[model samples]
Target: MNDKENDSLPVSALQHFIFCPRQCTLIHIEQEWSENVLTARGRLEHDRADSGYREFRRGKRQISGLYIQSEKLKIHGRIDVLELEEINPKGQSNLPSFHLKGTWRVYPVEFKHGQPKENDCDRVQLCAQVLCIEEMLGVEIKQASLFYRRIRRREDVLINQELKDLTRNAIKNLHALFQNRTTPPPINDKRCRACSLKDICMPKRMSVKSVKYRQSLFQPQEPL
Candidate 1:
């Protein structure tokens, strides 16, 4: 995709893409959405995180709802929380290099409704945010975090090369998916049961029914 088009993609879509490409296409490409109990709780969790609040406590500066983007990755989104830990400028440590004048440890924390998953969905999302922050601030972040509402605590994530590679691959696939503009067929698996868009998506029905005919029926065509 071109730079202009890539700029329009959101970082959150990477999580969706990781979870299920069809879900990503439905929400991003088709603009379809629905609310379920799970999604509602997740929204409630994000509401507090996205409040645009800032604070300083115990030698750390906490910034909520910080907007960030990456020209290289071609994704933009708001961070749930950006915690900056003050450090000794001259002290040498294993932390990432601080590009800015001040010495600080940067941490991007993402808020989620559930506990940590086995898949890379949440981690990739967090890593994408890290990449965006790195590009925007010209700094390297060695660690990030995720706050799960279910566990009511924070989990540390190592920003390693593997996670970065996964995130970059996901971004490339996301742009390609958007360029194709074709919604993928649903898998009708356990994930479909939890998805909020299950009703609208009709995964089971669509999987069994004639997708092309349904598309032709719903879409308008020009008269010849």
Candidate 2:
């Protein structure tokens, strides 16, 4: 895909692609969506996060529902919570806005509906947010955090090379999928049960049809 197409893609697509390519395609390419329990809960969680509030605490400034974009990464989206910590400007360069006279380090915090999962989906999403912040602010973000409602705690994520690579690759893959505008077949794993698109996907029925098609490829032909 070209740069224009890539820039048009949403940052959320990375998380969806990590969770399931088919799910990503279903939502982005096919433009299909259904609100199941899990999805509804997630929506509620984001709604709370995107309340558009700003708070000041000690040496830090907390801004919620801030929109960010990165031309380098070709992604744009709204950040859940961005914390800017005041720092002494020893020899640091000035940022674009004079309001931020003192050097401020940015830290992104993403909110989740459930506990930490045994996957890199959430981590990748957080890293993508950091990338956007870095590009926009002209600074390097070394770490971020994820706040899970279930655990009521924050999980710090390091914005390292591995995660950066994974996120970039996922974005490229998703852009390619979007350019082609094709939906991938489902794998019908346990994750499918919780997916909002399960009904529309019909993984089990599709899997059966796929099996039958494969079997028919080798079936003996009837005598004429």
Candidate 3:
């Protein structure tokens, strides 16, 4: 076992951290959660992956709900789907694969309840999965996909250096946050409306109180 495996956090926490650090802290640290319509819909969308099935077709192998972890990244989670395509070894005689007959390339797919977001949270989450698989199998994956149930489409994502760097940074930040064991102050922005933990977090009230505290610091001290 790798040294960091014992300290690993969940891969899903990367998405939560990227979306909002405070939200991530509330759930992963404070152990608080609430179910909203959006979250419930997402759970339903992932029902298919909960079965943990494997299938082979058209020279490709597919596995759903495969558990994966990366000691290097210090994260662990279950992948929604993993597709493997067979390829000739060619000049590369030392490629890692399933070890039955042929060399294979990995392609991970993450399922989402909604369409593509304007942020890289989903992409980072998918990339973390790829990193886990690469470490586990010793194969390099250069691309992955996201399946959006709402749009009914699969969007291809390049596992480029930028995305990998972003994913690693997020993982590092997550570990730091976990070590600190502190929930950050909330911004109470538009994103809060759709967040399931809004009521529990009370971002509006918290932000207002924070502002008043700062204002009081600058208030006149005539009576003093």
Candidate 4:
């Protein structure tokens, strides 16, 4: 893919990848969505997070939320939360948010369900957000964070080169998924038990098939 296609990635892609590649492809590529209790609860949480815009000051740090987008980044999405340095206090009202002073300073926060996982999925999403911010503000963001609803605490994240690579790779994967237009077979694991797509993915059935295939592979080919 050309640079144009690579950069055409969406910030939400990172989240979908984290949740499940198949689910991500289904939602983004197929434009399909069905809400279960888990999705409903997540939507509610985000709804509460998006309801208002608040910027407060505490010891020289300014906290703001619900920042919509602008001409920068060229991608449309809302950031969960951002911490900006205190500058240009009551300054220019006409200045675009991306041009606001402390433009080089930013902290992106993403809210998630359950606790942290043993994967880089969430970090990848946060890194994508940082990329958006960097492109929009014409600055570099080196770090971000995620807040799990279940944990009710923040885990610091770094948008280092590794994460940047993951973000780029993830975008490529998402593009390939869209091009293929295929839903992946279910991944039967403990994680599947909590996934809302259990009914649709039929992970248990897929797992059984996998087991049977492996068994057959191991079975002796004596008659050959």
Candidate 3 stretches greater than 4 Å from native = 1-6, 89-97, 208-224
| Residue range 1-224, candidate 2, lDDT tens digits | 77565557688988998898889988877889999877788888898579998998876889899988878767888999998887865536445552666677788999998899888999988888888888877789898999998779999998899999998887778778877875677879998978989999888887856967866888998979
Quote the RMSD, in angstroms, for model 1: 4.6
Between prediction 1 and prediction 4, which has the larger TM-score? 1
Q: For model 4, which pairs clash?
A: none
Better of 3 and 4 by lDDT: 3
Q: Per-residue alpha-carbon lDDT of model 1 for 1-224, expressed as tens digits?
A: 67575466899899999999999999988899999999988898788789998887875878899999887777899999998887865665423542334467888999999999988899999999999998887779999999888989898999999999988998999989988988988878898888999988899888835676777888879988
Query: Which is the winner by TM-score between candidate 2 and candidate 3?
Result: 3
The global C-alpha lDDT for each of the candidates, from Candidate 1 onward, is: 0.87, 0.84, 0.87, 0.68
Candidate 1 ranges beyond 4 A from true positions: 1-6, 89-101, 208-224
Pitting candidate 1 against candidate 2, the one with the higher lDDT is: 1
List, residue by residue over 1-224, the lDDT tens digit for candidate 4.
66544445466765776667776766777677778887788888887557656665651333344543323343335678777654456654322564454323567788887689887778877777777767766566777889999879999997889888887677667667766776675557777767776676667775757757866898888895
lDDT of 4 at 10: 64
Q: Write the per-residue lDDT of candidate 3 for residues 74-129, one digit (tens) a residue.
A: 78999999987767544353334455455677789999999999988999999999
- CA error at residue 223 for candidate 4, angstroms: 26
Winner by lDDT? 3
Residue 25 alpha-carbon offset, candidate 2, angstroms: 1.0
Ranking by TM-score: 3, 2, 1, 4
Candidate that beats the other on TM-score, 1 or 2, i.e. the better one: 2
- TM-scores of all models? 0.86, 0.87, 0.88, 0.74
